[model samples]
Target: MDKRFIEEQDVIFNAKPDAVPYNYRISYKVAQVCLILAKSCWGKSGCLPIKLHMISFALCSKEAMDKLLIFTQSEYAEVPIVRFDPAVNSAVTFGIADGLIFQGQNGKYALTDKGRFFVSKIEKESTVLSAEKKDLSLLSTKLTDAKIKQLSDIWRNIYAED
Candidate 1:
C-alpha cells in the first residue's frame, strides 16, 4: 500500500489499460475474479468485505482498462480514475454462470481446471498475459480487507460527487 493513500483523504486508482491482448480463451475482464470467488455457494474471498474490495480494486486498476487522455488542464495532464463500476460485477456473475469461473466451499473462487489450463497456455503463448500474471500476482499479495475497504471508500466518495 502507498503511504499517500493511507495519509490522504483522496486516493487515486490509476486505471490505465495494459498492452495485453485479450486472453481470448478466458474471454472475460479482470475484475470478476472476486465474484468468481464470492458468488460460489462455497467459500468467499475470505469475507464479504474482502470480496468486494478486491474485486472493486481490480475494476479500478490499470490492469483492467486503459485510460483515455483528456486535456482538462492546459498542460494536458488530467487523467480520470474510476471509483466503482457495476458492469464489472455483473460480468463476474456472468463468468460464473458461463463456467469460466467457479466457486467451491467457502465462496473462494478458484479458476476452473479449464481456466487453469487456459492460463498455462496463455502464459506460454502470450507475452501480454505473462506480464499481467505478474501484475496480478503482485497486487494479490498486497491487499487485506481493511485496506481494500479504505480504498473503496475513496472510490465511493468520487463516485458520489458525480
Candidate 2:
C-alpha cells in the first residue's frame, strides 16, 4: 500500500462526528478510493491519474460518485465531475477537477484544518472504545429479535400465498 494513502485512510478512519455531514461523506469515500489506488500503484512507476482514480473508486458503485457530486455541488458549488468522455470506457471517463479535493497544487488531496481536527478527535475516541468494545449489546439484542419477527412474518405470508 502507498504510505501516503495509508496515512490518508488513517486520517479518515478517525473522522469526527461534528464535521459537516457532506464534507465528511465526501472525504470518507475519497479516502477509501485512495487506499485502493495506492494498493494498485504499489511498486508501479506512474500513479493513477484522476480519471483512473474516479474509475477505481466508482467501479463498485456509482453511489459513491453520485453522493460526491451532490456534496461538491452543495458545499463548494462546483461541478467538476460533470464531464463524461466517450473515448475511454464509460466507467473510467468521468473526470472531476482537483480543486474540489485539494486546496493547493499538491496534486493530491489533503484534509483541511477542520478536517484534521475532526479526524483526530474521532481517532482518539475509536482507540479508546474500539468498535467491539463499545456497548451495543442492547441494540444487538433488539436487532436479533426484530430479524426473528420478520422471518416469522415471512413464513406466515408464504403459507397464506398457497
Candidate 3:
C-alpha cells in the first residue's frame, strides 16, 4: 500500500516487465540504503564515519555491501552513498560502508545535500508508480470469481516450484 510500491511497479512494467519480482527487491534494497544513510547523518555536521567491520556486521555480509554499492552507484553516481577505499593510500572505491571508514579525517560519510534530495525523489516516484498500479488492478474486477481463483492457483503453483 505504500507509495514506493507504485513506483516500483511502474519501473517493472516499463524498464523490465519480465522481472517484476526483482523490482520489489531492488526497491527495498535502495530504501534500506537511504534509511541507513539517513540514520548515519543524524548527528555531527551531517556526517557519520562508520568502519567497514561495523558495516559488515550490520549487513551480515561483504557481498551484500558490494551489491548495495553497485546498486547505489548505478542509480546515483553523482551523489553516491559511499566513498571508495580509504584504508589504503591508493584511491580505490568501495561500498558506502567501506567508504565511511576511509573518508578524510572528518571524512566520515554523510548524505550529501543531493543525496538527501534523491531520497525523497526515489520515495515519491515509487509511491506514484505503485498508486498507478493499484488503479490498473481495478480492471481485474471484471474477472469471474472462478477465473480469479484459477489465476491465483497458477501463481501459487508457479511460486511453489521454487
Return the top candidate by TM-score: 1
TM-score of 2: 0.25
- Candidate 1 versus the native: TM-score? 0.43
What order do candidates take by lDDT, descending?
Answer: 1, 3, 2
Q: Estimate candidate 3's RMSD in Å.
A: 19.9
Q: Over 4 Å off in model 2, which ranges?
A: 1-12, 15-30, 56-162
Give one digit per residue, the lDDT tens place, for model 1 in 32-142.
343223232122233342444344444345644232112111233333344444544564565556555565576645556544443444444444334445444444433
lDDT of 2 by residue, 40-92 (tens): 22222323344334333333334544543343235333232322223222211
Off by over 4 Å in 1: 1-82, 104-108, 149-162
User: TM-scores, in order shown?
Assistant: 0.43, 0.25, 0.29
Clashes of each: 15, 0, 14
For candidate 3, the TM-score is 0.29
lDDT for each candidate structure: 0.41, 0.34, 0.36
